[model samples]
Target chain A: MTRKREFTNWIFGRELRDSRELEERPDEERAKPYVITPLGTRVRRVLFCGLVSQKNADESMTRVTVTDGTGNFYISAFNSDFGMQAKAMVDALEINDQVLVMGRVSSYQNEGKTYFNVNPEIAIKVDSVSMDYWRMKTLHIARRKIYAIRMARNRPGSTATDVKAAGYSDLEAESAMKAMEKYPDYDLQEFESAIAAQIQPAAKEEHKSSKDFILQYIQANDTDGRGCRYEDLLAASQNASISQNELDDLLNSLGSDGEIFEVSLKRYKVI
Target chain B: MSDQVKRLKISELVPGTQNVDILVSIVSLQRKELKNERGESVYYYGILGDDTGTISFTAWIFPPTVRIGDVVEIKKASVREYKGINRVYIDAGSEVIMHPGESMDVRRSYSQLKIKDLSTAQPYVTVEGRVSSVREKELERDGKKTMMYYGDLDDDTGKIRISSFDKPLKEGSFIRMEGAKVSEYNGRLRMTLGSRTEVTEIKPSFQVGERLYDIHDISSPLGGVTVNGFIVSLGPKSGLVMRCSACNNRLDDIHCPDHPEAPVAYDLFAYFTLDDGTGSIQCTGGKAALLGHLGFTPEEYTPENKTISRRLVSSRLQEKLLGRAVVIEGDVTRNQSGTSVRISSLNYVDTDFMKKLEARMGADFQ
Candidate 1:
């Protein structure tokens, strides 16, 4: 079999319409007729076909980003919807995978750059990217989008219905609901800034110091050698610029990752 | 058997009688104090009088459970001295018997007595007079409800104050009074209407026109005057001893057997140092029993004589006395210390003036 035939089989079916044949037809008669503008505006309905760009997974959420030549957008899936069915879809998306994204076109302006956004209400990956990569990337984009909406709607006066209607995950909707109750005048921008300022730095530093500390502490003394107490760890981390809450988060991450085990209440030991 | 002294009238007897056996009608009986076994106390004393004279008496053993106006025969009662004044005392050893056969008509005792003739007798006598004024006051004394009605009465000879307890007599009404003891207060002869003093209003035979007076009207001209003032301070030394708690007898000493180191019960009294700011007087009397009846415990402000000094009398008593005009008939004497005037017999002027004042003051008086 010829490579062209293989490519054709991979893309479509046995009988395919040629590009010239589509060009020979009138604009209204074209199979996929759309316009892309440089100013982040698409005049006609456009099809975004690409492999998964990135994937990120956390305990609470998963996120995925998809990109074609024109622009890129994200989708998020929360733990509440991270069932086997959603996981299966997440498993299928991969980096560099060829996918067909069909959704409504939406736009957002940030930092003076207008970004064309498509909410991929539907997605189909092709043979170019692995199923695993696609799944992870979809999950990653879904989590990011979920987190963004959650952070946004946590501002004062934002309601759950508003967040949900803006296409946020259920977990995001729930968090926004609770935050709205607490600070009814919360500003969405302020909340997003706070989360960014809080989470980003810790997430960066935690990977290095926390992992090294756990490994060294476990190696020098057997799991119980010094009896890892939360208070003791807190004391050790006191000199750091990080806040108590951030340090606690790192410790939690370590515990969940099985690098340490909580031998007693608030006391940790190496796993 | 000295021929029973020829059935002597109380008027014929000496001013002080010792070991005198006499038959006399009890004009009034009041609760007084005596000591009991275990050195506790008891109440068995009161004023007993007849048509001729009246004296305070004490029953040493059993209390005489008798009412006012009862005729009683004292077989061998002896006179004793109290505070330099002589009083009669009867005991179980004395043949003190209540005689129903010798009943005396209470009203007839005052039937012939006129308000003007009362001054001639050495001993105080009752007189029927018309109430020219009546004043009713609602008061709370030591947490107990007490209403005092003070009024002036005139029998065309002179005017005297008629004070009713807990009730107000109608103004312009005539009332017959009996067993009212007389004393001098604030330089004026005053009569005290005790618990047994009977007061009943009757239709006046002649109407007395309304008389107008102010606080300044309480001069020497109104021989018996009624005035009111707020009680500023009270003291305990104003009256006699009180009954002991355990014994219920008047305690003469500071200590009692049950409470050997301290007196169990104390006779409390109030000396109202009152002022309208224009003038002031001090009214001292046995106030403990009255205060106790009104629900107050004696509080000692100073240690001397266990006296309650400079105390604020209850608001009810204050309201009853303060800012009102009263009529007092007795000798008005300047206190020996020359600090204030003392009116021994003080009563409210009456309700007629009070009603007019109330009308002028509008609802604020209420």
Candidate 2:
């Protein structure tokens, strides 16, 4: 007996896909669930990273919303094989935590509307470095998929059988045929722009030192027992190539931690 | 005289189209001499396509004008249903002219390939993996040995050996490399990093240090990863282990097997079973990693006035580690009972991250 074919792992973009159509090959009775994208990808498994926008979990089910710079992904972990893992994540995970989630494709319908969702298998907290890597990595994967979709259309015959015979796998060939049929003449500019915006190797956030840099700046400026003024702090940080937004977040985090305190309005001193 | 030709994508061709023009690449060509009732010749068939799709055409009694892979404009072509699909037949009086200055651009599918799927066909490829080990070897030639580094590169898919003659790598680092060349080495594909290759440390999407897996993810041997579980029990040779000073290999009750004459040094080790409810595995950690996160050293286990510390240490070590929720980073080696972890670093799962939550809710987190 031959082994069953594996479902294709998907690279996601900002585009939302909920086709409300369930498709399976007649030859394979085992159901491999997937959703068709306008770009012609049949998504099965996906890996994504984002900040936790929302999380809610009960004994039977858990749901989470994760948002990257481009868009948001809705994840549901029901009490099946994925229940205990989801419960652990939801009970321990907090809002605003940067998370990486890998899951399978899932969809539902409500009020005659189709909604695509991810059933998270592994959801874990990730650091800034991991977040940067995810963007860089995901961008590359998305680019390759888009290129493959274009290649399929460019090939001679341009049919499912033609693409398969042209050395592409059956999954890819099938997806290409489905995409051309489902979304005729769809523009890829929006998805391309989204990839471009997030794909620049995560800008190499030297953020490891962003917080420490602010604290040292505050210390150096506080002299004669007088606290450092906000203007002086901003000027020094800006000169050091630190953005105003990052400096502000660090200042606020430091202030809350009691590492520094406001002696007066817009003035702070190390405690 | 030349006239402006209409343009239709090859994918848009269908049955029942008359006098319609299309832009397509001549992917194939076949010229044949055929005999009709009066013995006639013909330019038989060819396949044409553009970025959108492809279709076939037959032009009988007309000269073959389009070359394979040449983007052409087919003017006055009519479509007909053939084999349940569409086919465009270019008869006489239709013209097939080269669409000048268009490239037959094709893309090869080798970009961003994972380490496990790497093959020798792809000379240059980009891959991402966690560096499990880096053992620098000396490439010898004419009594000179230039340094070369090789070790295991692992991802979620599988693990492979990676070697670089020019670049140095560290163990337990997540990295992405571009322009790395693949070459067959000892029946397996090995990636070589030359001067043109770029190697940069990558932040992995998952936690770099903590990789908690249940009994399922562990089947065979694995590279460096972390697993969180509870300590079930300990081995008889768990604590107070001696090592050969010359090689640091753990010694038996007599002496090191390889270094019999070498002096020995004493160290503490804890070997026990760790179960995460999915299954269990034997885990090993040293006294330092275990006691460090426990916020104490073996000195705390010793009695005052220079008393003995051997028997007392066993009871206290279990109190520190066994049945406790801890994260252990190590190499997973499989055996009959299942998988076991040879701990490299161990720590109690600290809640330092909870500070981020509290720090946001209020200004005075202290």
Candidate 3:
């Protein structure tokens, strides 16, 4: 049907993985080509939007590095399969121009380490509206995938179809399934924070302010350096932007980091 | 949520089954009076279906409260093979209970309903289908002449004829019709729109590209099929045209033959030949579709504003869409000159318009 696959995610370049390990594995069974990230994402394809920082072409192959908010992704267009696209990339595209690229993940092993890159199928020079639209769309998709992965993990018996029936798209469900199968005991808080920061930078900024307020309020209220009462601290922390639950987590972490100490029962003192 | 024996779907019923219980929607029912072992017996035989599948059934004892569209639980039923198909039978000793507080979710069932699932025995049904053709017919009944509009409606599953007595429909429109009268004609099901039916036009909620058929292989009228091809050339009628204001007919000059002193209105059209390497077909669009194809707003290039010339619009359309790989959806009507599509929607595949259009329509794409 000449159906071109649609990839709707703008993943950070840092979360990409080298597909060298899977390529090296010797198995008779056919496996779908996907790159596994540290946060346990199976990258079948990605909708990447960024600025063209550098372009390198040698005869039939052209390679370009694109810089996003977090990092840069290496993009390549080969000759035999993507002859016209490779030529266009080399001759037409210039550095510093924003482009949107949909591509499959590729990688190579260098000495002992592996690096990840992309083999673009659809690439277009875009203006600001197109670039920003793709960026926000990808951010939402990535965030949804993060949440779906966590929910699928908690429900082990659920299948990809089950996850899909629970409001996730087929691609996201399959990604979650692959994420679970590839990465075991996957810690998600770091990825959660990364996605949270990307989708809504304003919310993250607000959260940072609440963290600072908690620390300052504790320091100011601890008179005689004898620590502050729990009830009094809660009252003061409630005045800040964060919720009661978030305030509790901040207080526990502050104590664990030796920034605060328990002077008495239900009381805290800054260290 | 309990560890209980779940209700069986209609497809799970097989021959020689005993003491089986299932939840099924009564798709149809009819009472027949027969004389045999019992001098005269009244029994109900009909079809039942669930989300999984459908099966015909005969009930020796029919309950008064059990009606069509009621999701009911039938107990103590046995399965019997009838003409190579399974039929579940509930004897006179069995019970037909109208289980309260148990019905399929209204919204879920409506979205999942399809034209192929419809039967003549169904009293009322709701379905979404594409209008393949609309034709007017005149007939005499009881010494009175009446005009009727017939439309061929199709979904992915199959096609059915819709008889609209007073309602007018466009030749190629996607619509969701509710409470259509179901009837059988020539062994196939047909739906009639009477006083109680209502239809609302809807855009496609799913993608159509499953098999990009070779244009050469399609020999007959094809509906709801997706094809990918390149816009090879623009047709002669690809530019602007003037229509008679009073008659809505194409005018060769400033005046129409029907109304000599009538005013004229301007309109835009875009038709092009699409070649997919296998073959080529002519694709045509209406004014709205043409404007969307050209990426122009109606307000910018209306008849009142002569800033943009007809030749300019035509040349711009050709320059923008020609030679580009595109995906189109609609029916292909065949004649002596082969097939042509009345394009319902067209996409250039890798453009900004796809993102905007698909997102606004809430279409599910991957």
Candidate 4:
């Protein structure tokens, strides 16, 4: 039988980082390995949107840390044939660039804990509209899974058929059953609280002040005509209690308003 | 007699199971006549279902009174694998007993969907719509004659073609139908209703209108749908093209081989990709969809002009369409390669969609 294309799961960084169980496909050389999250979803590939908070690039490798509103996702691309496209996409990106990425999940174990990273296949700079769309879609899917799990938990003796009869999809039914069996002691409250917190309104006034401070810092810090380095701006914003995600949004808003532009990767100039 | 037989659900009818007893409702039934070594014989074959699932069953001796939707208990039946599918066979030792007071709830695996949601990947569907524009014809196959009804079904969402075998639908009648098989041909979807399909006439509750959809929700081929998106990429083959005047077939050479004596006509063929943030689709258009937008007239775009080149037309299309948001009404189709939309009508959107989107989605997050 021909292997079907693995589904690229649309999920947030918080849920993805919570995956603990890894399943190895039978074909050691040909098959792609995957991990089972606490939600009981088998994730081989993932599609997400986040801000580029950190980047380390060299001749052979490129690693970047991307942060959605909830948590951080680590992406690594190499110079090999499989990684060339991803590396080139990251090479063109600067700090605080919002991007959309689709990639296979790669994981490692250290100190009795598993750490997951993305081996990117495709990455592109996206607009705020696309980012918002991703967030909405991911939230909808997550809520559906959570509902299925809760239904199964309430009816402990229920089977997948019972869940399906309640109008959930087959994938959701199976995952809910698996989650019930695998993570019996897992805290459902924590997941619900996190999702509820996501619904809160963003801090608008605080954002305006941070945007102002960043603009002033860049205007005063272009000492040698190369403009201010992103690292310096990041440090200055951190001192003022601003987060990487907020800085990303501020820089993007500034660029859209024609207040600043990037002279090179990780270097910005006030226009 | 019942104590010795093992009762099981239809889903548990595994291959090579013996003395298998099951209580199921007849979902569908068809009679087959065959001339074997023992002379002419008749057998009933169809699908049986319970609350768990459904299974195909063949019986050499079937109860004469059993009909579709009748509940019957079969005892001492044998299950065997045939053509890689598990089937229940009721032979000489089997007994089918009917209990008049009992009724079983049949299992339905298909989802109730709108006409716009139908896809080839989904094998079965349950839908409700008003039947209209019915055409009846007699079709003969393998020395047997049957009546075939072809028509269009419309709900509030959209319209799709429905083909029924032997069963006739009244024009302008509202009905709810289940187990209609979905298939695609000539880049459009058609629902095939056969013996397995159950139909019920219903009172019309809603009015049908033009349906606009998001790109992400369009997973099937549909006719007459509208979408709002931005033209993101232009295809390489887009621009001016030559066609045979007599047949309108696209021509690569100066004159057409099929109509060498006929004149050649210059036409506009533009192709591009449309993205709406939710999803994206490749789109193709012809002279009717593009000529007015490209500022071209039939009299001016003739072969007589020496300075006018394909490059000019290509550049003109890019300048006017690339990254521009528009409302496009078209037929969306799917082939082996991927899904695409053939443009029937196109117009620029004057509204700032971001402002509209902010107004629509802002309340939830805020």
Candidate 5:
């Protein structure tokens, strides 16, 4: 049987890195093999947005690290005829730039330690709005799996339909069941805590003040019709003694809270 | 304000629950001004959630200080079913107290259903299907003429009518529409595209494929349907018939009153009840659709055997179709009598395929 194209799974770096098992279809040639994550995410293609942390290019290949605050995703684009497009995209990207990449996951075994990286099929430079949107969507997806797994663990011998009846999509329910069967001893609490801490950092009075300042700055400076630029916010944050990481986090949190809307790429508007 | 009221989780909410108290964080918030018969008033609507689940909420009197992601406790909230989904309503009688510094992760789930599974019960829905047809018309609203496009969309499961005002949809495009408003009109499910609805053209990993529907799921009258079932019984009119060559209408007698001089055409009409275990439907077809299955060729038909053809065709149809598993791809139509499928293509399911099909349907129905 001819295998069809696989869906691009929207996943975060944490879960993607946590995936350990790769399943292959030996019976069907040209079938896209997939990895089953500890959370039961059966993914072959993945779509994610993150900040480019590192880049190394050579005649043979281009390697880059993309981090989504939670963890890092290693992407390798081979400089070959079949991988020319991916290599060009990786070559064009710069460190600290936000980018969205959809790619196939490939795993290799070295010294008995299996490692995984993405082979990009499509890559585009995105802005904070797109980045934040991807973050929120991926976070919600992750949370749903967590909840489904928890439900499955709570109800012994529960089927996928039972989990689906608890208000989960069939895909999520099936994935949870698969995860339970494959990772029977996986620590749910530890994974949940780590994800939650990364998604929602502890609130502080200074952070609150900075958020207020960011909102006000956008409102006041968005007068030229084109929303407030990322550079303007960066300058404003620097003047207010807010670090780059804190500013990014504040922007993401504000975007997630629906207080600030990104009108365009790297432009903020108070909604 | 509500010391006696019982605090309930969002998941615990049911329809017609009165004087309910709950604490939840606002996951989504939207402020809207409504101008109605009573006059203009501002209200807030959004989704609220606890650790358990999420519920849509409406607040006629809400604090401006509270925004999305703020945890708040409500006293005297009422739960009511609106558009088939339970919603929490906060009116003047309700008091909302904000709890700053606290947060909650909202668990939101959307029903993933095919076109056939859609109902008005799901107010907002996301569906993926191919646009089967498109009809454009102009509508006058508030003295302004706006174009509205109405059409049908179908997937492997079934088909449904879709209409969009001001939003034009192209035919034959495989699109995924998110947050479309589902409504019912004259016993038909219709999905309307509103401003909030998001439409995206997607390249499906798998083939968009043919329209395959269970007998039970055939509600809307549509085309391009593939139904699998056993021919249980034949209709009274399931035999050979004479059609007026001019208009192609079936003639009750040998002579056509209107086109008396025109020659009559010999046509084989077969009507049967197709039962696929879940349900049954009346199906109709003509000689072109049934000749091969009936083991007859057009060359064999002549005016000489017109009298004997009826019995031969009836028995042949029964012999070839009755009590046998078959597949019919056709169009569904509704009239005063009921719903029936006009067969365009018919095929008998092989024994091996029938076994696999039964296994699949058994799993599906389970």
Candidate 6:
């Protein structure tokens, strides 16, 4: 099963109890059953409901500490190891806010103290429940309109406001706007597709040229000892004669070819 | 001409040659300093030597990544006279290649020889000398401790001090020397050793006394002389002291009480005045270390007793040694204050040499 699906299933079946009842149990007793339980014992997969206590960034790792009143544990993401998923986790966190972390439990010993560590497979902002559910359902239709407008703006000579005037709603337009902020070197169509893939995974097949164009540009300019710069490629596209849809298709194709690598957000270089 | 001409060992290369290429084993390495006509510091050079001979090479274009024992092929290099001494300089436009593991036929160079044969060389001979005076000097260049030392030795016939190393030799106590291209210092002749000078104490039959000699008297053809004199005054005028601001305890910088952001002060002025009847002058800094070897401590002149003022001590000591007859050997420097002489090794003169001098002077002395 997919990791996300497993996490959702665990959350649906876990035995829920009041937070106070869990806290009253002695620490030794609480951890004993979890450790000695044979692997054959139906493994208990559960979702932890907790308040975000701390967030730390060190080099390439981001660790978030969460306290569920009964205990506190850490959720670590090595951004170098899991790029997009790690970034998504960092973007969704807010200190003191409540969150639902779904993962497997493992014990760790550090400085002679034993603590439980959670390798979270899924995380969601608890406050966005009812509102976020409806938003996800209607998101696809709205995103398509936004994608069309972004593609239009990305045309060689088109202005950004020209896409807004073509009838994209403010929030839909703002989603593309925020994606541009995250990927400054991305052309409007590439930005739209990257965000679209996150919100609607099937949309990846819909836009392929944006990735191919980036790959071709990186290969052409990477001959000099120095690697190609992302901004230079984006600027080149602005001056190229290609249509927006064709450019989008090119970038996606290049990503699959592995001729170019994303060194940083919006920063692409020849591998 | 045959394209496969036999390669010449570095020692076999004639002193005067243009575009000579040779493969040689590095016998020693010594660091060197040179200034351009504009007084701008240009290169920190080194000397590389083989059993055949030694050559001076400049490290201006690249940092020296080569060590003392690496064998390298010097291609299209040239030999030239630097300040009247024969030395080798690599051509700037030439390509110098280094081979990490290639072996070449070995031949001992002149600088690699012992004091026995060094004495027979007619007039000018290149030889390695042991360090007799190493003083750490703090200057305002890179805010680092620079060490300057005078090495003294007898090439069997004479002794001289080779000025070397702006950085302290913080490693082995014994310094190995090589590639000392002979030159003149003041009116007396001396030699300047380079970085490629080999410093090792593993040779058989090595005796410190056999090689020790007075740098000044070496050129005079005078054999052995010793001097005994009283210390009139002593301290380092250009000496260094590091003190912690918090507790005022003397520190080694690493353990300052204030630490990290603590303020530590470095004082660089101390001197000592000594007299041996014939002459006396101020000795400062590492020169003062010699006094400690003779039995004196920094606490002797502390302010509590106030027996001697710092300035008075220096001056009185200087005057007391003004005309005392004493035997001493080492390097001497003439500075603005007076003539500063560092005594590398000393002993009292016996009555023999004195009686000989008295007999030569005849009845006029009586």
TM-score of each: 0.24, 0.36, 0.47, 0.55, 0.38, 0.29
Candidate 1 residue-wise lDDT, B1-366, digit = tens: 232423444544443454567777675555545455667555456556665656656676543467777788776666667643346677766767778757863332332354434431223356677876678888898999988887777764446666667646777778767756555455444555667677777665543433322222233323333444323344434443455666766666656657666545555444555432223455554552245433445464223434342233444344343333344333233333432333445544444544453353233213
Comparing 1 and 2 by DockQ, which wins?
A: 2
Candidate 3, residue A96: how far the Cα is off, in Å? 2.0
* Model 2 misplaced regions, further than 4 Å: A1-10, A13-21, A25-32, A79-82, A159-178, A201-271, B1-366
lDDT per residue, candidate 5, B218-298, as tens digits?
776665688875565677678888888898888998778899988888888888877553357889898888988776668
Q: Chain B TM-score in candidate 2, rounded to 2 decimals? A: 0.47
Cα error of candidate 4 at position B306, Å: 12
Q: Model 2 RMSD to the real structure?
A: 20.9
Q: Whose DockQ is greatest here?
A: 4
lDDT of 3 by residue, A54-142 (tens): 78877777888775433457787777754575456444567766676666776666776667777775565666545444444455555
Ranked candidates, highest lDDT first: 4, 5, 3, 2, 1, 6
* Model 4 agreement with the true structure over B230-267: per-residue lDDT tens digits: 56567878999998999999998988999899998889
Number of the top lDDT candidate: 4
DockQ for every model comes to 0.00, 0.02, 0.02, 0.10, 0.01, 0.00
| 1 versus 4: better DockQ goes to | 4
lDDT of 4 by residue, A40-141 (tens): 777887777777878999999999877665556789989998778679977877777877777788888887778888988666676655555566557656
Model 4: what TM-score for its first chain?
Answer: 0.73
For every model in order, the TM-score on chain A comes to 0.27, 0.61, 0.60, 0.73, 0.72, 0.32
Superposed by TM-score, candidate 1 places the C-alpha of residue A66 at a distance from the truth, in angstroms, of 99
Cα deviation in Å at residue B296, candidate 6? 12
Per-residue lDDT of model 6, residues A1-271, tens digit only = 2122121111111011101011122554654223211001112234444557677776676677664322244677565554555446654677666565655555555565444545555555554321122223223323343364455446644444654565543333443444343333434343333333323325434536545445555654442335654444543343233444665566566657776656666556766
Worst 10 residues of 4 chain A by lDDT: A198-207
User: Backbone clashes per model, in order?
Assistant: 66, 1, 1, 0, 0, 63
Judged by TM-score relative to the true structure, which candidate is superior, 2 or 6?
Answer: 2
Which regions of candidate 6 are displaced past 4 Å?
A1-271, B1-7, B24-33, B39-75, B80-86, B97-319, B323-325, B329-353, B356-366
User: Which 10 consecutive residues of model 5 chain A have the lowest summed lDDT?
Assistant: A197-206
Docking level of model 6: incorrect
